[model samples]
Target: MQPHEKVKQYLDTICEQIRYKRIHNELREELENHITDQKQAYIAQGMDEETGTFKAVEQMGDPVMVGTQLDRTHKPKPEWSMIVLTLLLLLTGTFIRLYTAPRETNGLELFYRQLLFTVVGIGLMTLCYKVDFTILGEYSSILFFALAAIIVLLMLVINPVDGRFIYASYPLLLFPALFAGVVYSMSNRGYSGVILCGIYFTIPLILSLLIPNITITLFLTLSYLVILTIAIQKKRFKVNQHHALLLVYVPFIISFVVAMTNNNLIYRLKIVFTPSLAPMGVGYMGNITRGIMKGARLIGQGALPENLQGLTVEQVLPLINSDFLLTYITHRFGWIAFLIVVALLELFIIRAFVLCARQKSVLALLVSTAVTLTFAYQTLGFVVTNCGFYLFAPLSLPLISQSSHYLLVNMSLIGILLSVYRTGHMVHDKRFPEKPDRRPFLTIEDGRIIIDLHLD
Candidate 1:
């Protein structure tokens, strides 16, 4: 081997054994530094430069062995627990749509359609798993603004099927995720970044209000607050933590209080907590849900409300297959089934929290936290509506929903969360720039080199 080519040759050989190509340059840089340091140490001890280089290379062990060990250590890990929980949740929802659904209803048709959504959801999740999640941080600016603009265009300009812009809610659910990236972009900018984020945060809330989507508004608010609180607690912001948090939360408190007092929001809350206030109309669903729940048994089935007067409990719920799934399950298979579904969802959420804490990068942690909390929001909403708090209403919870839009959006978010679990440790926002990766897949043909440029 040529004198200067030895180190290059050794590194290339070691790298060849590694499977994760995105990390190759970083690993090569670290290994090169170590080898260079060892070589200089030998030279300082009076060895010739050539001998020093050779000794350093020899000391590092066999290239293939070193590479194999590193590849094992650095390989992407699939969160099997997470994956299994997801599949179980999907199955649980499917079973409810198929088996627990009323015999008189189109249960088999609902099952078939759910099966299709589940299949598509899994595909989106898998595609996201293969993605580089950290890029969400790098392009936070354009994404946040552009998505905001798209919402306006769609809701105001496009004004699709309904004038109410109900379709905006699906895309609106994604705002918090993109806002996570926005927070990352501003982490180093102190209070100004917090202010900027607060400004951008209103876009979704406002758009949701335009759609008059209170559920989504609450969803966006809860998600924004969680993201903001976590960022402050982590000391991602350069400003004083106390002041930064105050700047972020005082407005939230004041706004919440004002909203409560300024309109019937407070009265509606009262009726939700005390359903008798509007038993005939506003609290209609709440009263029915309460009566049925009170009469539920541990197993078998629950008694229907006296006021059912001829219609099934499922007929009363706004969207039994999607929103009031747990309520329906309780009425069909009893509280045991309800408890089982609830426990499964709770476990999956707890596992996601553990995954979020395990992340080594800020972008991954923030985005993952956002996704996890969004899941929590939807779940809590469903539970509240099921428990007779009809003022807030229920939002869709992934595979458990009949709405195709909910299935796709929720699955896409899950995909991003799963992506964080998969390649999160492998990507750093700064290193993996927003620009397209030019790194080519290199292979040696017989006596020739072929470069396969993969467009991300």
Candidate 2:
């Protein structure tokens, strides 16, 4: 290929970097229009039309540089602090889980699973980072449909055969599906797209209520809603300074009323009200609450026999390993460790939101919002439930769980981050001349390689 041909290939790749269908259409139109304008200018410069066009194209700068620059203008500066915080939190959580938790028959096995899962998740995250997330828009609907099918398989197909299902380990895939839907819809239809995406997730969530997997259902639905809320908020309040704020509690009010009227809901609500309620129900939360409370007394010494009594030795907490991993932290590492965990979670979420705000493409922003919502809501739910209220079952504990489902979910979030960052960094670091690599060259029948150089 000639020099100009190489340039065209590079531009095409850069355009693919921010590859939303809507944006792609716009970029194509823009490139064609620019090319035409350039050709006209070349003709005016006293040269043969074709020769003028060729020289004009070369003089305008490489197409790749132009396209890459456009993409970069929309990227955000990397936040190193959040990355460090996430790493520290994940590493510390793993250490505490391995060394501090009470031993059981599956002790070594569980530890191995947790460690292996983390490695696998990080690898998956790296893979996600390798591509631009905007490419995910094309498969958003498929992903949503697949998740729905999987939910069905777990509830109907797998549960019956195994007497249980493994949804908890990685129910977080709901975020990517819902997020992709939001990105696609928002680009095509604006805010209404968001509302439709919410409805899409909500329907399955309500359906899941009766499927013995309410936690996963609720988690998915809540994540979708939270993301939509962010979009709505962004629409309501653009950047710069905020004026006055009116905090509304419409959903909270409705939920409170519903719980008050229903006995089962009331029982569930009690979990959030009193940690003690856990012991009376499934033994998961109750054990966690009792263990954390007891563990907090010692704060870092763990639940050794010598200090067990001092750390609420009389209390017998159940499920100290999984749902109640927080308790294990308090028992072994102390309240400080628990606080650090919370801080790290908050930092991870905040960083995600920042990415959403800084993204060049609307789809990336919305997807980032969805990812943030999923992690934030789950984190809040986990914390609120563990604080003494036993309102819900133990969901996957993010980075702490050995469940394959949870592990995948956590990795998916990381994937979103890394992918977005790769694109985002380019936008931030090189706003002037972003370009992709050149295309492969081919020999022509003539002495020189001939190339048809359409800007688009």
On lDDT, the candidate that comes out on top is: 1
Candidate 2 TM-score over all chains jointly: 0.71
Q: Give the per-residue lDDT digits (tens) of candidate 2, residues 58-82.
A: 6667656666676666454445665
RMSD of 2: 13.7
Write down the RMSD of all candidates, one decimal each.
Answer: 11.7, 13.7
TM-score of each: 0.85, 0.71
Model 2 per-residue lDDT at 45: 76
Counting clashing residue pairs in each candidate, in order, gives 0, 20
Q: After superposing candidate 1, which stretches have Cα over 4 Å from the reference?
A: 1-9, 46-55, 100-111, 149-163, 309-311, 425-456
Error (Å) of candidate 1 at residue 152 is 4.3
Model 2 worst lDDT window (10 residues): 239-248
Maximum-TM-score candidate: 1
lDDT of 1 by residue, 313-377 (tens): 76676566766767777887788988888889999999999999988888899999999988888
Which pairs, if any, clash in model 1? none
